[model samples]
Target: METDFQTVEQAKSNIQALLKGIVGTRTVAIRDALDQVLAADVLSPIHVPAHDNSAMDGYAFNGAAINPAGMTQLALVGTAYAGRKYEGTVKSGECIRIMTGAVMPEGCDTVVVQENVTVQGDQIHFAPGAVKAGDNRRLKGEDLTQGKPALRAGRILRPADLGLLASLGIPEIQVMRKLRVAFFSTGDELRSLGQVLDEGCVYDSNRYTLYGMLTRLRFVDLIDMGVVHDSPESLEAAMNNAADQADVIITSGGVSVGEADFTKDVMQKLGSVNFWKIAMRPGRPMAFGHITNPNTGNAAFLFGLPGNPVAVMVTFYAFVRDALFKLAGANPTAVPLVKAQLASNVRKRPGRTEFQRVRLERQGSTTVAHLTGAQGSGILRSMSESDGIMVLAHDLGDLQAGSEVEVLPFEGLI
Candidate 1:
């Protein structure tokens, strides 16, 4: 059914409400869990350090030995290297030479960094202010306590998370099964990469761009269904096939109210789909809903993005990206936005929100965003040349130079 034009926030909320988590899980080696959503809470099996240890190459001794008014000297008994233990206890007025990560000897509650002390034969001397109690000592269970939850479910595992798991001797982890996504470009004028371009036809760049974006997510099994023509038979067949195999089906073009486009018809015939005109620049026309195969009773979530190159990217990042994350059983993650001064004047209307392509640079102490030439939807180079997107809000009008605006960087997503 046709829905009236809605604001970006409203559209996003609607899409989010319709999403359902995909079920299934699998166990994979920790090395293979990067970018995969964690399926279960991982409780640490043992203390991270297991025992009190030295954080530096130094001497371990009781802090009480330090005299507040003068230098304190302590006799060095023995040495303790990493993986090696000093069996004997440290007595008063005595210290043990300890390497980094070495177990702290009994009766020692502090460490004097090697550089802070002067060695004189069997004695180590340091000023009263050279070290403090409990300094340079890594206490047991400081990093992660035994039987505590180290990592929670629904987190997208990153490099640091893998290191945490490895520190606890965890060899494998439970992760949600990757979401399957089938996508294709629509329009008879769309041509494949190797095919010769006709008079009016252009190469289908949407498919390639979509492929790149999906690949970076790393949690999706991508199926490039090639280019589906603008016909009921072709569109319906493609949608059904995609629905049968994938958890989400994405298509570019054929969504707008064009006389020749049959994408809307095929979508309605298959299942419930809502056509929406979001109040946003670059991408406005969009279709969202679920497509169910009548014969097989299989279904998949749908996202019909705009045909323009930049619009496809903008819409995907603004809407589809988060939806896909939710559908994949990932925890909600907020994309960071930083304020930057505009290097030049920008013309913006008040009603619809705008995503202007901008290249950021350091202007003295303040970061500034310069417009990437023309802001045309068909100009894909604008996106390539830009470092981030400057979000001009719906209530904001034309902005002058040096005005502060929020910019969403392309750091993690690119």
Candidate 2:
């Protein structure tokens, strides 16, 4: 009945080390690559803005013709629009009317914005100090150069990356394959939705929340195996079935030190699973390891999260989230943390880290964090009303009002 305790940092390191192998890769169209991790470096095939072009709709002229101390007037030669070029050369004392994105004409090195110039007949007049040499011009290869790396491997593709690839005339790109994740809740007291709930039983909400969290990742193939009973036969059957189809298996209950729970025994019998008491509040008991499929002998990573609604989310966000990203071939990314002043006093222990749900308020230029109602492991409403979690470190004892602490917002991942 003894528990093996590990600090938060140590547990994270252990979990990451277990999932070091990268997933396989596949080719996908740029449009279909959003949120997928890049498998190889993307090199630009050609220079962006292949020719020197105008960045503004203005007059293009030789910069050397401008008088330094007084106004200068130049005769307008011709007009140039985007996709159209002025074949004639611009000499001193001559200018060409140009539109935005138009290729710079021959011998033109500067552009005076139209608002800064006055036109009378064929003459355009502008102050000498209104424009400078090489003003309002986009040079060739300024945004991206040919044969240079535009995006590195292991980068998660965003919407803008697709546009960047389209700009480079790349229709498709290489990206890591989607991760396969199978999850289920365990407990005889749990029931699926639309089922009549008997005494001492409740409809399972863990699977729904897990589904939402996995769906937001956008690159996970989720297998919702419903709820498994707390019996040796039932738990082992579920694990074997999940291991055959998934790279990772997530279970929401039966990880705590309870006599009725058979998940720990079944996991240990099937693979090299470890049950640990992590030094963290709300999510203390967890099981992590690799489980082998008895049918096919293939192995899959296992994450046994606590049953409490908030604990399941917190443990997944703090540990399993990053591990899955690494296994899916994504570059290491840290969750963004921002410092905020505490609106009230907080009490804590010295040995365990605590994650308190809080609401963020903007008081002038400072961000202030206030607790969201009650801080309980089973309180699902607190998470819904909270903007983020205020992390109280292990070495920290207590915090006074107006003290600053780190908070991880639920912006990028909800």
Candidate 3:
């Protein structure tokens, strides 16, 4: 099959088209639910502040043209602490003592900050020319109006979102469930963890890398479907077992056109398969498909990542991870990428996309990114020690120092 590898923008569009509203909808609690995309529009059931209040500890007075600078004597009403509102009206030349978050009295229009006013036995002294109208008042529903959209669909809730929801007294929210994912590795040269390595057997680093990456995504279930050797029957059995329970299956290695590889043949027999060699160095031979579990008649998407540590990581981040978000009912939203100054030079191939691991450091109030030395595909240490991928354009072969480049934080879209 002729597989014209999709460009980044084209790939994003394709993923969007394939996964529009794929998660459907579900509900969850607000506690510890940050980054879970909102499934529905959040309508403000009530006003945000619920009432007009003081934003700072201050003195509330009418200030109805009574010069506060020259005013010497004023009656001191009872103090209004936070969560307590003084219900009485403020007459001329009279002020109410109000604390931060306290509701402002009905007749008061201006607030004199506590620093600008002095209290002496039922009398308050205001500094010269200090009366400011609406200085410290938090207007009712200033943040949001009744029936207003507090939050929109497809938004990944953050700390502020949680705080706003809590302020609205919404203890729970509707969110799509996490993506259920299953992954495995196939190779005769691979060995599981804690097992003594025999000659020619390398520890399967791809499995752990995929596991960690999936863990960072906070998926509903990151199931390890176990190791499958270079056998068609074993590969088929693993696929059938995983597809029955998992929404998506992720396999590392063995998608290339090799005689020992059984992933492609099994994918064809079980379900439709689409294989492609991405135009990216260290991650070129990545593949994607769908698989049908024979026993349960359930089908799920399958991803075959390259064997190299760097290739698998980059491909997982770009391709497989996006697919998992779609399966989890997320908005298929693109993760944010920021531009930062480059501290050192970076060189790459002109035709292939490169994701260089970099460490962003603060140097004299400016953040600069420097490439980690080892660029080999087998180096897992680089990915662990660095911040995130510094994506280089396909046509650009070299990035000079002091040039601004995209910096993807490790914490993004987690």
Best by lDDT: 1
lDDT of 1 by residue, 287-343 (tens): 999989998999999999999999999999999999999999999887889789999
* Candidate number with the higher TM-score (1 or 3): 1
The models' CA-based lDDT, in order, is 0.92, 0.90, 0.78
Could you tell me every candidate's TM-score relative to the true structure?
Answer: 0.97, 0.95, 0.89
Residues 1-414, model 2: lDDT tens digits:
124678889999999877865568889988899998999999999999788999999999999898889998999999989997678888889999999999998799899999999999999999979899899999999999999999999898999999999999999999988999999999999999999999999889999989998987877789999999989999999999999989999999888887364667799989999898999988999999999987799889999999999999899888989988888888877878988999999998888889999999999999999999889999999999999989899788989999999998988572
Give the TM-score (vs. native) of candidate 2: 0.95
- Candidate 3 per-residue lDDT over residues 120-233, each given as its tens digit: 988888755775667778899998998999999767788999999998889999887666788998888888988889999999888888888888775457888767888889
**Higher-scoring candidate on TM-score, 1 or 2:** 1
- The TM-score leader among the candidates is 1
Better of 1 and 2 by lDDT: 1
TM-score of model 3 vs. true structure: 0.89
Model 2 stretches astray by more than 4 angstroms: 1-4, 259-261
Residue pairs in clash, model 2: none
Clash counts for the predictions, in order: 0, 0, 1
